[model samples]
Target: MTRESLCRLDEKPCDVELRRRRQDWRRGAEAAYRYRQREEHLDVPYEHVETVGAFPLGRWLSDQRRAYRAGTMTGERAAELEKLGIVWDTADHGFEQNLAAARAYYDLHGTLAAPRHATALDLAVGQWLTNVRRPGGLGKDPGRAQRRAAALAAIDPDWNPRERGWTVDWQRHHTYLAQLLAEGARLTAVVPGVTWHGEDVGRWLATQRRDWGRLSAEQQRRLGELGVRKAPRARRTAAKTAAASGPRTGGAAFQKGLKALQQYIAREGGLPGRAVVERLPDGTEHRTGIWIANQKARRDKLDQAQLQALADLGIEWA
Candidate 1:
C-alpha cells in the first residue's frame, strides 16, 4: 500500500489507530503472499510488506508464518489488497501536489486533463483534443493533465487494455477518461475512488453525436489520429495500432506455448506445475515440459530439451 494510503484517499489525518488498523490488514496480506512463493523465504512477497516500510513482518510474521494468513480470498479481493497496500506504502506523497500542478496547468493552456487511460503521451493529447472544440484547449491545463496522466501511468505503465493479465484494468481505462473530460463530458459521483475514464469519453461523445461532421479540423484530426472513426472505440483502436507496431515474435510465441501447455495440463487432469516450449517442423511448435509439483523430483529429471525451450522463451525453470 502507498504511504499516502497511510492516511485515506483525501489525504486526511491518519491517526495512530488508523495506522494500526491499516497495518493489521497489511500483516494478513503479507502472510497470504508468503504462501504463494515456493522460495521459502521472505524478501517479502510484497503483498505482506506495507509501503515505504520495512514493516518487518510486524505481528503477522511474529510467530507461525507457515500458513496462509489471509485465507483463500477471491482473486479480486487479493488483488485489491495488494494494490491498496502498494499505493499506500510505496507510492510517493505528491498526489495532492500533482493534482494541484495539473489544476494550474489546466487553467491556462486550454488543455483538459488527459485521462489515466492514455497510452502514448502524444496520443493522450490527441485523445484530449478530440473532445475539445476549442483548438488546443487541452494545452491550457497541460500540467494538471500531465500529473493525472503520470498518476495513471504509475497505476499501469505498460499494460495493454485489449489483453488480459494478472493486473486490474483500471489504469488502462483512465487514459481515455481524460480524453472524455477534454471533450467536455459531464461526470457524476465517481464510485468512491473509482475514476471513470473511457466510458466518460464515450458519454461526452454521445452528446455531440449530432455534430460529427460539424467538428473542426482539430477534432477531425484527433479522431483520425486516434483511429476512433473506423474503430469507434479507443481501446480497440489502441490495440490495433499497437499490434501493428508490436513485436509479434515473443508475444505470439508465448500465447502459442501457453495455450498448448494449458491444454496439456487440462488433459493430464492438472498441470505438473511446469511447462516448456520448443519449435517444431511445419512452423508449429511443441511443448516438452514436466508439471511435477515435487521440487526435488522435478529437478532430478530436468533435461536438455526443457532447458533449451525455456531459454527460447527467455525464462529459466530451474
Candidate 2:
C-alpha cells in the first residue's frame, strides 16, 4: 500500500477521528465507536461500551441531566457521570426556558402548568401563578392539563416536579423568589390558592421581622438585601420596665431561707441541714427530703446579687 493509504499506528491516523468520536460521545452521540472498532479490527487503546448493564439507565441519566440543568449536579458527581459518557450541557437554561414555557402555556391555554424541567424553575413558575391569580387563582393544570404533563413526562417518566429532593437548587430558587417578591409578587402568585405557611409575603415578612432570630444567616442576608430589615424590638412601657426592675420572687425565697439559716445558726449553733431548713417552714411537714435537697443543689441558679447576699451573711454554700 502507498504511504497515504497505509494506516500506521505510529502516524496516529485515528487521533483526529478518536478526538471527534470522544466529542460525539460527550454530546451523547448514539454512533458506537466500539462497534466500529470490532468491525474494522482496529487496535484502538480506548474502548467504548454503550451499556454498563445499569438498569433504568435512561432514568438515572435523565435525573442527572435534570440536576445538571438545575445547576445542582456539579463537582465529583458530575465528573463521575461525565466519565460514564454522560455529557452535561453546562449552560443553565432551566429558569429562562421553564419560565418561557410556563408563560406560553398559560397565555395559550389560560392555565398554569408546572415546569417539569427543574425544581427551582417549577417553584418560580408556581410563585408567578400566585400573583396573576388572586386568593385562589388558576389551580395547577386543574383540568389535568394532559398536553403539558405529557410533554414533561416524555422527558422524565417519573416527572413529579413537586416531589421534594435533598439536592434542591436553593441559591437559584432564593434568587428567583427574592426577585419576584421584590416586584410585589407573592408565593401564592406562583402556587395559586396555596399560602406559604398560611400567609402571603406581606404577612410572612411581618412575622419574619417579629421572629428574626429564627431565620438562618443566609436568609437574613438575603432578606436584608431585599430591604426586609428586622424591626427594632419594642421597648417596654414604664410600668413594664418598673415591674421588671422589681425584686425577683426568687430573691425573696432565697432571703427567707437565708434568714431561717441565720436563725438556726443563732438558736441551734450550727449550719442548717436539709432537715433543719425543711423543719423551719410552716408547710415543711409535707415537703419531701428530695425537694429540700434540691434547694441547696440549685445554688448556681441564684442570681449574682442573691449569691452576694448569702456571702455577706458569712454563710458558705456547699
Candidate 3:
C-alpha cells in the first residue's frame, strides 16, 4: 500500500477511538443528569454507582474532578458539569457540607462543642470538626485551610477548644451553664441533678468551684463572666477536714457513687456493663459495676432516699 493509504488506515482507528470516548461521555452525562434530578445535588459519594444503565457515575465524576484539578479538563466539559451544579473542588464541597451541619448545631445549642459522636443535619459534624481542628487536617493548601478556619470561626470563635487551653468537655459544660444563666437560672439552683443536654451541669459546676484554683486564669475569667466563683475558704477547709477523716461514711460513699454513676451515664448514655470501671474527673476510680451489684444485693438494708436515687438513675432493681 502507498504511504498515504497507510496514514489513512491509522487515522481511521484514531477516529473510531475518539467516537467511542464521546459516546461514553454522553452516557455518563445522562446518568449525572438523572442523579441531580433525584438528589438535587451533584455531590455523589466516591464509591456510589448510578443504578441507571449501571454507570460508574461516581468514579466518572471523580475522574472529571481530577482532570479539572490538573487543568486537563476541556472547557466544554467543565461548563457542562458546572451547569449540573458540579463542584470542581470536592474538598471544598465536603467542607461546605460539614459547615452547614456545624451551623445547624450552633443554631440549636448556641455552641459548637459537639461530642465526637454528635450528628447534625444528617452529617457527622462533630467528627468533622475534630478532624479539621487538628494540624494539617484541613489539607495542605494554606489558603484553602485559612478560608475554612475563618468560616468555622465565624460560627463559633472557640470552635477549637484545644486552642483555647480547654477540653471540649469543659467548653460544652461551660456553654450549658452559660445558657442556663442566660435563661435566668441562678448559680445556686445549678446543684447536682440539674442537667442540660444530658450533661450533669450541677455536678460539673460544683467541680469547677471546688477546683477553681486548678483552672487557668483565662478559664477562671470566662467562668467569672457567668458569675461562677470559687468555693469559699471555709467550705474548702471543711472539705479538707472531711478528707482527713477515715474512709467516707455510708452517706458520703453513696453520694460519691451516685456522682460517678451520673458521670458514666453522661458519657456513655446508658448503664455500664458488668465489667466496667468508671473513673471520675478528680482522678478517683470506682468499680461501678461491682458497686451497683453490691447495692442491689443489700438493697433491702438501704435507706428510702438511697433506693430512690438508684431508681432515678434507671436501676431496675432499685
* Candidate number of the best TM-score: 3
Compared with the true structure, what per-residue lDDT tens digits does model 3 show for residues 125-187?
A: 989889988899888989988888899999999999999999999999999999876766556
Could you give candidate 1's per-residue lDDT for residues 1-318 as a string of tens digits? 576785566554556567886676656566545543434433343335444344544444332222234453445644654443322221233334333443443443323333444323223432432333234322356775455445544534432222222112322333454443344332221111222332433443343333556655555555445433431335788688768898543455444444444333323333333455533323565554532223224444545544444344333444
| True-vs-predicted CA distance for residue 306, candidate 3, Å | 27
In model 3, what is the error at residue 160, expressed in angstroms?
Answer: 0.5
The lDDT of each candidate is 0.41, 0.46, 0.85
Task: Give the C-alpha miss distance for residue 115 in model 1, angstroms.
Answer: 11
Estimate the overall C-alpha local distance difference test score of candidate 2. 0.46
lDDT of 2 by residue, 196-276 (tens): 222232344555677888767766786677766776876669558747799655655655565454434433434445554
Model 3, residue 280: C-alpha shift (Å) = 21
Candidate 2 displacement at residue 105 in angstroms: 8.5
Better of 1 and 3 by TM-score: 3
Rank candidates by lDDT, best first: 3, 2, 1
Q: What is model 3's C-alpha RMSD? A: 10.7
